[model samples]
Target: MSDRFDPILLSELIASHKQKIADLGVVIRYNESFEELEDKLPIDSKAALTPHFATALNTYTSANAFWLGGFDEDDQLVALSAARLDDLGGQAMSEYLKRYWRRCYPAEDGDLAEASETQPRFWNEVRGRVAYYGDFHLKREGYQGRGLPKVFGPLAMLVGAQKWDADWYYTWVRERDWSMRYPLAYGFSRTYFPGLRWVKPPSSIEPDLAAGVNSRSDVLDWMETLSRPGEQALNK
Candidate 1:
């Protein structure tokens, strides 16, 4: 993973993703003035937009950028996706993440402190840096397979690769959830991280992506096989 990422660089990645969404006929606006932002994207009522705004702002404040999904023509929100640098702190932000972790993982496994320790090892073994990439949503009506991942996942990866200097990227997904299929299709593999629980979304579609041999496993095999071989071994 590239190790030079900072807050500003991360923000640029979010901006680029926003542009891509716009190109796809979606509107992704940042709340420059929190007050104006609040006015434009109200949260008082019980609606999808409230959580979307809250999650987006929280991610931006903590992680540099958030990609909130919405339709341009109708101005309806469809899904939310975001990433934050591994550092950045605040009670609200911590609490927000805690809630998601609790929802996504099992309470019996352990607390956050124990669970967080696995991150470094996971990164090293997987050859990827950790970036939080959830809060994904898709309105039931607008959901379609054709362009969603192309619109968000690769954009996030490009942003992560460029800004964060990340060689690889990782996210937590529930085992049974169909969304997990998207990452696998994109070359992410399942490695064990303790204390993470797999939660099922209310409804999910089976993922449709090309599959061949296990790409991640191949990466590991190449490293193990070529660590020091033949002439190199003889020289050593």
Candidate 2:
């Protein structure tokens, strides 16, 4: 999609979200190093770095991917998110995944053949310059019920769009996260069940997954709603 946003309005909305998080006693930093980010992730994190952002195996320059971390009063990393440009050009998302499933999520004796058969019908229609946001984590101790997702969701998409001019934003959501209705909280408008059907799934990761998607137009409209005067968008 074209960059149709008002720079001033975008800046204001981004600042507003950052301020909201700061009020919760978290400091945000735009990190350029994925290695540092991988190191900073909690050792016991169930949501470990996916192969999409694995620096050891993949090279992500500033133009393609970006990561950020939030720190508390003691400078401890408490929350984090990352986004990357998945340039599909004219290929369907389902086809792209089928071609790169092992590269994206490497596992021995894995089965990804079901993707071609069971993927949502919309996957064939979704293509071109997709911004994939993932690696969202929170420290659970004091972050829950604080409305951080509302802030992080929009802020991450806006930044990704600004950098990549992505047509669509998508991510793979865990089954539990979907059950909790976090997709709605994250400003995603559409969700598809059984986004990826693995026949021989790995025991290390959550087997079931759903897809969260938002068109650039949808995100722009959401920003417009949030930027309206007296809206109090993030709080809701």
Candidate 3:
């Protein structure tokens, strides 16, 4: 864990979030096995598992990445989220994405090269240690409207912050999910429209996305908020 924050307060904040979700019959645990974790993800007609966290495509270990699995009373995996450290010493995120867009979204092949040219203004400001978050999936059967995200999302980012001390927490989400306020529930401070675009994008993934962002200060403030009275547990 990073030493930038108070250890005592950090522990308390994490415990508080854990307890809040525990009431919903969910137990959260950290895992480093991306290969196994990927197998556990729900296989549905959504965007294919992101290559950013796929073990076959990229490298993510205990040293630089972490995945959180939320299981229920039956010990069945129901929610998933992961983050990885993108250390760009002095490079802009847009430039980095331009070069790796194919690696990150290999499923989209036709006109994939066009993705490199599309950049949101906010992308230029992202630099240094970045906690690139993705691979978030939550079953909708019994977990949709129970306020799982209120705690789960923040808890994921909190764990990411502890591990990376990242300058920013960033992700690209479907525009519909953004319209549904998923990013806000995930603790991102800002959301930029048309984050990533393509001229003839494949139908497998959304052609456009809303980029979610959360600065280090924003994360710290969230932890402080949870430490206060009446905010220890989120409402259902």
Give residue 105's error in model 3 in angstroms. 2.1
Candidates 2 and 3, the one with greater lDDT: 3
Q: Which residue runs of candidate 1 sit more than 4 Å off their true CA positions?
A: 1-24, 28-63, 87-129, 178-180, 185-236
How do the residues 72-191 of candidate 2 rate in per-residue lDDT, one tens digit apiece? 999888888889887899998877876666545534455432234456677887799888888887777888888777787767777776677678888889988888777767767778
Model 3, residue pairs in steric clash: none
Instruction: Compute the lDDT for candidate 2.
Output: 0.76
What are the per-residue Cα lDDT tens digits for candidate 1 across 1-236? Answer: 33343446445555765676777677754322322333333222324332323544343452444444455587654544444444322222222333444443333334321123222233233223334454445444454654655456545444444445433344544445434455543324444433132233112212121111122333233223223357324422
Report how far off residue 182 is in candidate 3 (Å).
1.7
| CA lDDT of each prediction against the hidden true structure | 0.40, 0.76, 0.77
TM-score of each: 0.46, 0.87, 0.87
In TM-score terms, candidate 2 sits at 0.87
lDDT, candidate 3, 103-217, per-residue tens: 4553445544446475776788889988888878887888788988888988888888777778888887898999988887787878888787565454456777889988788
| Residue pairs with clashing backbones, model 2 | none
Q: What is the lDDT of residue 78 in candidate 2?
A: 85
Deviating ranges (above 4 Å) for candidate 3: 1-4, 43-48, 106-113, 116-118, 199-203, 229-236
